[model samples]
Target: MENTVLIKNATVLPFTRQANGSLNLEPQIADVLIEGDRIAQVAPAIESAPPSASVIDAANHLLIPGFVNAHAHSMEILEKGNHEASPLELWMLYTYPPLQSQHLDARLCYLRTLIGAMEMVKYGGTTIQDDLLELPYVTPEIFDAVAQAYVDVGMRVSLSLHTINQPLHHTVPYLSDFLPADVKQDLEAAQGLSDDAWVDLFRQVYQKWQGYRGLVTTVLAPSASQRVTPDLMHRIATLSEEYDVPIHTHLLETKTQAITGPELYGESVVAYAKRHGILTHRTAIAHGVWLSTQDIELIAEAGATVIHNVVSNHRLCSGIAPIRELMDAGVNIALGSDGMSSNDSFNLFDVIKAAGLVHSAMDTSYDRYPKAADILKWATYGGARSALLHNEIGAIAPGMKADLVLYDLNTLSFTPRYQLPIHLVYAENGSSIRKVFINGQLVVDQGRVLTVNEADIVAELQDRLPEYAVHRKQILQQAERIRPAVEKMLSTAVSQSLSIHRFSRPLHYVS
Candidate 1:
């Protein structure tokens, strides 16, 4: 007996690629038939449906494929709105402080991940590439808890043990020179596992948690190029090749980081990764904001993906990514909310709108600005490619996974809608999302989640906040001790010359 659900009389937006390599989206009133976990049919009319099939009337509704969040960090879910606009380097010290002593309980990890997962699913996000990292190091229990949250909520997740093997001073340029002897000693004492131990940690977690629910899978995340050793990168590459999984890593996201490649590796980070076999079609680079023209070429040549975190970039003052250049160079672009602490939300609708508008300043010609259709494509198809699920997900068509979002046409966002794709990019904010289905299962309906108890999770999070606040203050206190020195490092790096600049204005003349 096959399970089936038939959604009737909805305006279906099926994405089709044209001969020119652009997406063709045609919205037609149709019925979508889901057989088990896959879409069986999408047509103007379905004359026959199984007697036991469930049916929903979707008149005046717009059906589209759910958004794929190509890159994110579930670990930062609890840190939302805790900081103001700051440089990435300075912001990281507080959010990911090295001197932290406590580890989050596994149950707390589950609850925190659920909070983000619930927000994502409610807001039309069906898939996430979560580069989840735990401070100090990741453990099997913590990894399982996070993975289980996504499974329990019925959303697809590509989970990675996001880690950095290199010492703190080695990752950021000029950090050792700026660090006081006492601070340096404390950081060295707090250093995490060795390279080989981190590899074993990944293997232990991957073997147990991979394919847990056919929706949760593991990825190789080495944190960043400058933050990892050649040995670790090679090991990650080997594992990636052996499993055919995606590699999610951060690249140059800020001006300070832009100087890191030439400062540390004598080349761009992309070239460094290529030398280590880490740059491949399966590689998905998060935040290539400071990549050079040559770096972009190398990424394109290797068939790698660069996820554009537009909202986070602006929030952290990281600078705009060369999305137009990347697209022109044949690099696939995807969108990411980045982290809760940075973007402050899990809504891809916000990311979509921001991504559509942020690139206009990149060029004077309007023709070069991002198209609403292209932005939607990046959020869906490009993200699926980044997640290594291009063949299985990212489209609303026969043989695609039954992950879909139905937006109410009567909502204010669509009330006299001129163009639906445009509204989805420029106007919509997930408020009109009436129903969301993942893997043929209805997880969100009429602004409510069906899979988990949001109330309970919210209550638990609130209950733990007092204690959490204490730890946060302590972390901030520790970070404040090094704030002066870190600011100096940032100023020094940004003041240095680079082949390209991503800032809105020339940084050299700032003072």
Candidate 2:
């Protein structure tokens, strides 16, 4: 028998756009009827509920589509708050290098991925574009485990085989010149998977797992131009075409990255992407913080998505993405939590709040500012576009997949609320989450995940933390050894004058 859920008397956000370009709610209390995994009806009373359907009384609740974390890294949940830095290279060196040495098995991979998925779903995230990179490299077992964990958690995930083709020393510009002989040797000697090896890995994972149960999908992530070769980027582009799946790439997240395209390809990253045939409707540009005006135009023309990780950007001091300009250029803007290592939580509610507020300070034009509903759009529909699943999810409508978030109207965030959409964007936190339905499954009920024993997951993971701490301490010690060189490189890179300015951090700060 097909499972059905009848949610009763819920005020919902239809995410409808007004003529003045602001967002408004549907202005109706409606019942959402779900049959199997699809929304059967959304109307007044929903009178045709089947006898076998489970009824959920959702009175005094706000039902909206679950938010999509368009770009995220799965493994970073284990390394949360281990290191903090404001610049990209320094952030990577301090935060990521330690994990590269931590040997991981399938179980660890599953746990790492589960924690991330659990966090996302717990905080109103239903779908995510997971850029899952195994530390050092990806193995077939590790890859499958990550994807399976998402399904086991009942979350929709587009998992990417995240790897870079470029050597470590070459990935970063001018860093090799700044390092000591031994340090440079260590970095230069660091090898990643070859083109053929990566392709084989992709084929292995793809053949086994993609499009799993229609909840799991696959994306080919070439990491970035700074970390990926042109040939690999082209290959990934081809795969995206062949599979009809979106491709995600980190583009111009930092000033140093913004410098790479000009230094190496004699153009901007957007132009370089165009040259490599990577600029497409299927391409998702993660952290396009340093893109130029021309770059934005090209991306809009190509119909690519620009994923905004506002919390991640602020944490790494990566600067504000030109979201207003991009939106004006008709570029699809999506939101992400990045990874717990940088953003510290997969709670995209926080990300949604950050996205709504961060851009108000970036530009002077009040009219161009992203309204609260705009942020919701980015969180929902824009995110669906990031994974090329716009038609199926991202909205609460009949005939669509039943992925919905029920927020308690009694929460403080909605207290004395005059407007629904505005209050949701500005004031609400995760406390408002009453229940979450994904693909017609009650994955979260009464604000608790039902797929797995979260406490047991936590307990089991906690049992392993003592041994992991030894690795954590050792990696922290290792990070200190290379901090001086990394800081020097950062200083050198910061000293040069650029054609433009992205970093709002003044050249000097006053006490």
Candidate 3:
């Protein structure tokens, strides 16, 4: 028998994309009916209820589609508040240093992922495109632990075997010239697992966990365009085609990357992706902060998505992305909080607020700024596109997956609310979220998770914090050996005179 649920007397944001590319977000008071894992109906009134249906009195509640965190790294949850803000390359040296040994046990992996998942659920996020990378390498045991964590939390994840085969210096610009011989030798000794080996590992993981329990799906992630060989990129493309899944990768996130793209590929990175048959509808490029006009056109023509990690962009000093230009060119845009190591939060509402406000500084014209409704759509529907689940989730309508969040309208965020969409974008944080449903299962209700012992997991992770802090200090001390070389590479890479500008000011600007 199919499980049924009926929610009564709630305000609904029935988000449906229209033919002209605008979202229909006209709010109305309605009742929602859920059967099994799909929305059965949404109407002004649901007159009859199924005999087996569980009912919830949702009076004075604001019902909306659950937010999708299109790009994130779940493993970085432990690194929150541990690192200082620096340029992308400099920060990565400590956060994901190649020389660090893999030290996390399988239980630690599970516990860390659970902390991230639980936070997202508490903040009204239902789906995450976890472009997850394990330091040094990924093992099947680690993969299973991560997947099990998501399933246990009752949230959705598009997990990727995100990795790179090229040497660390090869991926970063001017790194080879700056690294000392001893440091270079140390890095080479710590070279990653071979391309064939990772592919084999992914094949095993994909065969085991693709669409497991309707909560977890798999994607292929080559770390970036310049980070892998052309042959590996083609293989990744072919695998994506074979599995008919989305491909997630980093592209042009910093001015250093902007310089590296032309230096390595002899053209824009987007052009290189096109040459390798990687720019497609299934391709989602994270942090496209340095795209050119031509690059935007190619991505739009190929129907690729650019996930704007707005807060992380600013937090890492990567500079603002040309979001206004991307939106003008008809390219799909999604919002991501990035990893906790970078943005330090999983709250999509915070991301939505940032996405709405930050782009205004890029353009003086109010007309060109992102609309509140559009930003909300990017968080929901655009995120669904990034996950390749546009047809399945990201909306509140019949036949869509029953992933919804209900906010108490009586909350201060909605007090005397004038415009529903505007309040959602600017006023509301995660505090107003009273109930969250994923796959027709009420997993979070009134500030508590129903699926697992979140308090126990949080306690276990907290108990190990002192141990983890000691380990992090050791890693940072080891990383100090290479920090000067990385800083030199960053300075030299960003000093190059690229024709485009993503920085708030020109490279030569003096304070």
Candidate 4:
């Protein structure tokens, strides 16, 4: 027998936009019927349901689609606060080096993923893109463990085996070179592992966990264009085409990357992608902070999606993405919190707030600013579209998956709320999350996760924090010790390059 649930007396914020630019925020005092794994119906009130049906009274709550976090690195959840103040390159150098050492074992990685999943679910994010970047210890067991953690927590996830072809490269060219020699060499060796090995690993993982009970899916992530060689990119793209799955990559996130793109490839990064025919609807580029106007148009024409990690960009000092320009160019835009290490939080609502504020600041036109509803759509529908799960999830309409979040409007944040969407975006935070349902299953109810013991999870991760702290302190100390040497090396290199440029200037100046 199929399970059914009916949520009654809630203000339904459909989050669906109309033909006109205005949002359809008509507060519907309706009953949302969930039959099996999809929304059965949305009506003013259902007279009766099956006797065994579960009924939830949502008298003072707001029912909306669950938030879809389009990009995240769940493995970095444990490394959050330690690297918060450092610049992007320095932080990566200081933090990620330890993971390549003995710090990140399978057990620790799984625990981090579990904790990350819990944080995301607690904050009303039903779906997330787990961009698990290449770990030397990454194995089929690690993939299964991560997937199992998500399933155990009842969160929808798109798991990507984050791949990089040149893992040993220092500083990614545009970024500072801070990687230690040993760490760089180890990563390079890992990257040299045959593509056939990765394919075999992915095939095993996909067969074991893809679409596991309809909550988990597999995605091909090539890490970033700069990190992977052109041949590897082509192979990954071809693999994605063959598997009929989505591909995720980081693209044009910084000015440095934009400057380096032409040097790496004969053309711009987007142009190179276009040449390889990898700029398809199945591709989603994260960040895209420095894409050109032409690049935006190309993405739109190619039907690709851009996931704007506004909070991560600000935290890392990466400039704000031209989201307004991309939207105007008909490019699909979605929102992501990035890694916990970058943004320092997995809360999707926080990300929405960041997006609204940053875009509003950029445009300087209040009327043209990204509205709450616009971000709401991006969080749900645009996210699903990015993951190529548009038909399965996103909205609260009938036939869509029963992925919904209930926000308690009885809280002080929503006091005397004139407009629901505005209150949701500006005032409310994760504390307002009353319940969440994914795939017709009640994952969180009354501000707690139902599938896992929150106290136990927290306690377990807390106990492991001491060991992580040792590693954290060791890495930071090592980085601080080596910092002077690395800085001197960079300074010498810069001076030599400048001298060459100065000496090479034309001697016969007609002017």
Cα lDDT tens digits, model 2, 1-511, are: 8889999999988654457644456557989999988889988787788888899888898899999999888878888876574676766755567235545668877887888888888889999899987656777888888888999999999998888655555765666766678766665556667789988888787888877877988888877766777887788888878878777889989877777777767887778777787889999999999888898989999999999999998888788888888988878899998988789899888898888887888768888888877888888888998898888898777778989999989878899968887887878777889899888899998878999989988888888777777766776776666677667766666666676677676442111
Over 4 Å off in model 2, which ranges? 16-24, 98-102, 507-511
RMSD to the true structure for each prediction, in A, is 1.6, 2.4, 1.7, 5.7
Q: Would you estimate the TM-scores of all the predictions?
A: 0.97, 0.95, 0.97, 0.89
* Candidates, ranked, lDDT: 3, 1, 2, 4
Q: What is the C-alpha local distance difference test score of candidate 1?
A: 0.88
lDDT per residue (tens digit) for residues 1-511 in model 1: 6669999999988875668867768788999999998999988899788888899899999999999999899989989988898888888888888776677788888988999999999999999999988888887788889999999999999999888766678788888998899988887788677778877977887788777766888998988988888888999999898888889999889888778888888888879889988999999999999888898899999999999999999988888899988999999999999999899999998899999888887768998898998999999999999988887888888999999999999989997877899988888899999999998889999999999989989999889878778878888898987887788887788788776778878643221
As for candidate 2, its clashing pairs are none
Clash-forming residue pairs, model 4: none
* Model 3 C-alpha lDDT per residue in residues 1-511, reported as the tens digit of each score: 8879999998998888889987888988899999999999999899788788999889989999999999999879999877677788878877887787765777888999999999999999999999888878777888899999999999999998988777788877778987889888888788577888988988888899998888889989988888788999998899889989899999999888888877876888779888997889999999999999999999999999999999999888898999989998999999898999998889888889989898788766988889999999899999999989999999999999999999998989998888999999999998999999999899999999999998899999998888778878877886888888887877677678877788777543121
- CA lDDT scores, all candidates in order: 0.88, 0.81, 0.88, 0.77
The weakest ten consecutive residues by lDDT in model 4 span 498-507
Candidate 1's TM-score = 0.97
Worst ten-residue run, lDDT, model 1?
Answer: 502-511
Per-residue lDDT, model 1, residue 377, is: 90
**Global Cα lDDT for candidate 2:** 0.81
Alpha-carbon runs more than 4 Å astray in model 3: 506-511
Q: lDDT at 152 for candidate 1?
A: 96
Question: After TM-score superposition, what is the CA distance of residue 204 in candidate 3 from its true location, in Å?
Answer: 1.6
Worst 10 residues of 3 by lDDT: 502-511
